[model samples]
Target chain A: MFHLLDIIGTIAFAMSGALTAMNKKLDLFGVFIIAFVTAVGGGTLRDVMIGRTPVGWMLDLEYVYVICFAFVLTLVFRKKFEKLRTSLFLFDTIGLGVFTLIGLEKGISVGLHPTICIALGTMTACFGGVIRDILCAEIPVIFRKEIYATICILGGIVFFLLKSFHLDNDILYLITSLVIISVRLMAVKFKWYLPTLEKN
Target chain B: MFHLLDIIGTIAFAMSGALTAMNKKLDLFGVFIIAFVTAVGGGTLRDVMIGRTPVGWMLDLEYVYVICFAFVLTLVFRKKFEKLRTSLFLFDTIGLGVFTLIGLEKGISVGLHPTICIALGTMTACFGGVIRDILCAEIPVIFRKEIYATICILGGIVFFLLKSFHLDNDILYLITSLVIISVRLMAVKFKWYLPTLEKN
Candidate 1:
């Protein structure tokens, strides 16, 4: 079940990356690179920081295939995909939730502190988009007061708090992911944002 | 001698990152984050690619101290440092040279392909600045047809060509680093650049 969610998230992120690359007029190589990075860059960073080498995508060629499929899909139906922005946003949010859980689980398995785990979760969920924006030569939405990383952080806190109740692992995962996706959707619906710093 | 060069390069990169962060009007935390990323980001990426985990800085605190020292130096004497742009550029070039060597050596030690090693060297020397630029919401100089990563790739090729003659290790290091530094300086002085893609 979690694996399915992971695949969905990866595809969503990859499509988003591919679309961004096309908008930037990047060549084929740049498009694929951006898509791959946007899908896995965050997890790669987390793995590297925690001493998990050869990373996930390196170990599993499935991600490569998925991202390539996403790239081609986006390229073929750019207009149709653009029109489905709402659906894409939903998938991206789901991806964010699952990614946060994966990161938090990895951190716990490694015996890191709770605070550090929350940070790792946030990094895992958001850094991929951060990397995509950076590669596209734009400020990351998370850093721009979009309330993205904040949602991941809050979801992480919820994960640990629920864990204290000794709930079933599946139940815990479901609840945490739901919270993240709901919060993200609400943030968008309400046009909620953190305050930006004033220009000096 | 190589250690000294590494320190010089780290400081140079840190200063460059800190300065960019300041220009972006990032707060102190953001400044430090950018400075640290700029100093170690390339090496960290290289290390992660080759399955070296916990990375170099995570293993040793010396880099942290050096980067911190660099940040404080840049912060306190911003004007003086700005006036020393030429000197700073020289240090940065030297840093690039040594960083390239370090990356190349690491790749070779891990028995990676020669082409991959050269690519790793270029990435190790340049990606920190790339990360800094991306974080600062600017296009990376390396990606912009600047004669930067090109020099590192050429230097890597030179290093291996010289190795065919079996020179002394210290001499090889010095010659390779000098070649890289000279090429970069000349590229800047001569306004040399790779041809950029024509906008569609």
Candidate 2:
């Protein structure tokens, strides 16, 4: 189940990156670079921060192949993607859920302090999008008082509780992912946002 | 002498960043951010890679003041900066020298392998501009060619040789910086470029 989420998340993230490249009028190679970064960048950072050598993508060549496939799909069927935005968002939210749970679980497994683990999980789940935006020359929505990071943090805390209760792995994963998705979706629908410093 | 060069180099890099931000019509905060990153991003990366905790700018608040002063000068004296393309290039070259030498020396100080030190120096000297370009939505010239990284590598090797011969730090640093600057200026003058790879 987690493996399926990984693949789904990779594709969704790649699409978002590809869309960003297209918006920026980048060439094929540029688009591919962005796509690859979006797909693996978060996990790669997490592994490096936690001192997990050999990195996730380096360990699994399948991630590379899948992202390549995503690139081809984006290149060959660019127009079709315009129609897929809504579904793509759904897929992306699912991927976010999966990424959040994976990050939380990895943090716990590494025996980090719970507070640090939650923060790490939030970073792992959301920073790739921030990086993508920074590279694409757009302000990262996450940094602008969005509830996006908040959702990831909440999901991480929920994961900690489920683990304390000794819930089954699959059950814990699903619950955590669902929470992230619901929070994010509701945040968007209801225009929930964190308060920001007043701009003069 | 090296201290003077360091200040001049940082000023040149910051000016370039400020000019780029101006060209992009960025806000004051954006310009400041670009200038700060251009001035000190290289050193920060060097510290991070070497596990030098509390990266350079974070440690010395002076770096912050320097960057802000540069930004303010650029903003206040916009007309003077507008006519300084060549002057800016000269400063950037000087910066290339100081940054490359300082980066290489710092790498070796941290006990990285000789080859790694050279690579780190190259990255430190050039990656700031690379990041600056990426943020401004341009293709980074460093990634596009060998000259940027290659020049740093050559200078780093020269530094190691000079040290092995027990050369004075000042003389060794001058020689390395001069070599890097000369190579970069010549590359720009001669329009040096490597062969491009076709799509895979």
Candidate 3:
């Protein structure tokens, strides 16, 4: 189930990146590069931080194939996909939840402090988009008023809180993912945002 | 001697990042974050790629202290430093040279191919500025027509070519660094640029 969710998330992230590249009028190589980075950059960062070499995407060629498929899909159906904003949002939210859980688990495996684990989870869920925005020469939406990373952090907190109750691992994962997805959807639906500081 | 140069390079990179942050009107915390990332982000990336755990900055707290000192220096003497553009450019160039050598050596230590080592060296010398530019919501100067990264690559090639002559390690280092700094200075003086793609 986790593996399936991960694949779905990867495709979604890749499509989002490809669409952004298209909007920026990037070359074909640039589009593929951006798509691949957006799909795997967060996990790659997490792995690198904790001393994992060759990174996840480097180990598995499937990620490359998936990103390529996503890029082609975006290129061929740009207009059709334009009307799928809600679906894209849904996939992105699911991706965020799954990524957070993966990061949190990796941190636990490494025996990092819980607070640090929460940070890792947030980074895993958000840094892909951060890298994507950076590559596109834009301030990351999460770094601004977006409620994205905040929701990941909250979900991480919930993960640990439930861990204290000794629930089954699969149950814990399900609950945490649900919390993240629900929070993200509600935030977008209600137009919730963190307040930005006024320019001085 | 390499240690001293490394410290100097760190300080220069930190100052460069701090200046960029100030230009963007970032808060004090943002200033420090940007400064720290610019000082160590390149090397940290290289280390991560080569499977070095915990990264250099994490192992040595001195980098943090230095970045903080640089940030304070920038914060206090903003106006005075405005007239020091020449000094800043010199420091930046020297930093680039030293960082390239350090990355090249690290890559060699890991037994990577010479070409990959050269790429790593270039990344080390330039990625800090790339990160800083991205954080500031601008395209990295190196990604455009700037002759920055090209100089590092050239220096790396020189390092290997000179190594074939069995030069002493220190001599090799000196020659490589000189090549990088000279190329950068000459490029800037000559207004050298790679041709950018025309807007489609």
Candidate 4:
């Protein structure tokens, strides 16, 4: 079940990355590279920091295959992507939720501090987009525009809070991910955003 | 010693990052973060990819101290930074050479392929600047403007070529770094740059 969610998230992220690269007028190679990075960059970073060798994607060729499939899908349906935006957004939110939980679980398994765990969670869920924006030569949208990472951090907190009660592992994971996904949905529906930082 | 060169490289990279951030009109905190990233970002990325846990700076606080020192020095001497440009450039070039060597050695220790080791070397010596540029909302200057990474790649090849001759470790490292440094110096002196790619 977790693996299924992960694959869904990777596909969403990869398509979004491809779309962004196309919007930027990048070459085909550049588009594919961006797609791959957005799909796995966060988990790769997390794995590296936690000393997980060969990285998650490198160890599993499944990710590469999925990303390639996503790339082709995006390119083929570029014109219809506008209509698919809502669906894409839904998948992206799912990705955000699942990736955050994965990061939190990895950090907990490594016995990292709770604060560090939360940070890892946020990074896993958001840094792919952060890297995507950066490669497209823009400040990361998360740092300025959205309530995205805040949801992951909150979800992480809730996970730990529930863990204190010795909740079932499966229940804990489900609840945390649901919390993140719902909050993200609400945030978007309500048009919630962070205040832009002004030059002082 | 390698350690001493690494420190010098860290200080130079940190100050350069600080200087760039200040030029972008970032607040003090922003400047410090950029400095920290510029000094250690490449090595952190390299370490993470190679599964080096805790990372170099996390294990030793010396990197943090030197970066702080560099931050202060850059801010205080901001007015005179123009005068120090040549010296700073020299230091940055030295960093490029030394960092490439460190990365190459680490790859060899890990028993990676020669090609992968060269890539690791280039990443160690160049990715900090790439990340800095990305954060600053510009395409990485190295990707377009300079012969910087090419030198590191060449240096890596040279290192391996000399290794095939059974050269002593000290002499091998010295020659390889010298090759990188001198080539970079000449590249700059000759104003050598890669041709820019146009949007197709």
Arrange candidates by DockQ, descending: 4, 3, 1, 2
TM of chain B, each: 0.97, 0.91, 0.96, 0.97
Error of 4 at B100 (Å): 14
Q: Model 3 over residues A153-187: C-alpha lDDT tens digits? A: 89999999999999999999999999999999999
The superposed Cα distance between candidate 2 and the true structure at residue B34, in angstroms, equals: 1.4
Note the DockQ of each predicted structure: 0.17, 0.07, 0.18, 0.19
| Candidate 2 lDDT by residue in tens digits, A111-150 | 9898888887777778888877766677887898678888
TM-score of 2: 0.58
CAPRI-style quality class for the chain A–B interface of candidate 4: incorrect
Better of 2 and 4 by lDDT: 4
Model 4 chain A scores worst on lDDT over the 10 consecutive residues at A191-200
Q: In candidate 4, what are the lDDT values of residues B3-117, reduced to their tens digit?
A: 8888899999999898887777665655765788899889889988787885766556678789989988887788887788899998999899999998998899999999999
- Comparing candidate 1 with candidate 2, which one achieves the higher DockQ? 1
Error of 3 at A21 (Å): 1.0
Task: For candidate 1, list the clashing residue pairs, or say none.
Answer: none
TM-score head-to-head 2 vs 4, winner: 4
Q: Mind listing the fnat for each candidate? A: 0.27, 0.04, 0.30, 0.32
**Candidate 1 chain B: 10-residue stretch with minimal lDDT:** B24-33
Write the candidate numbers in order of decreasing TM-score. 3, 1, 4, 2
TM-score against native, each model: 0.62, 0.58, 0.62, 0.61
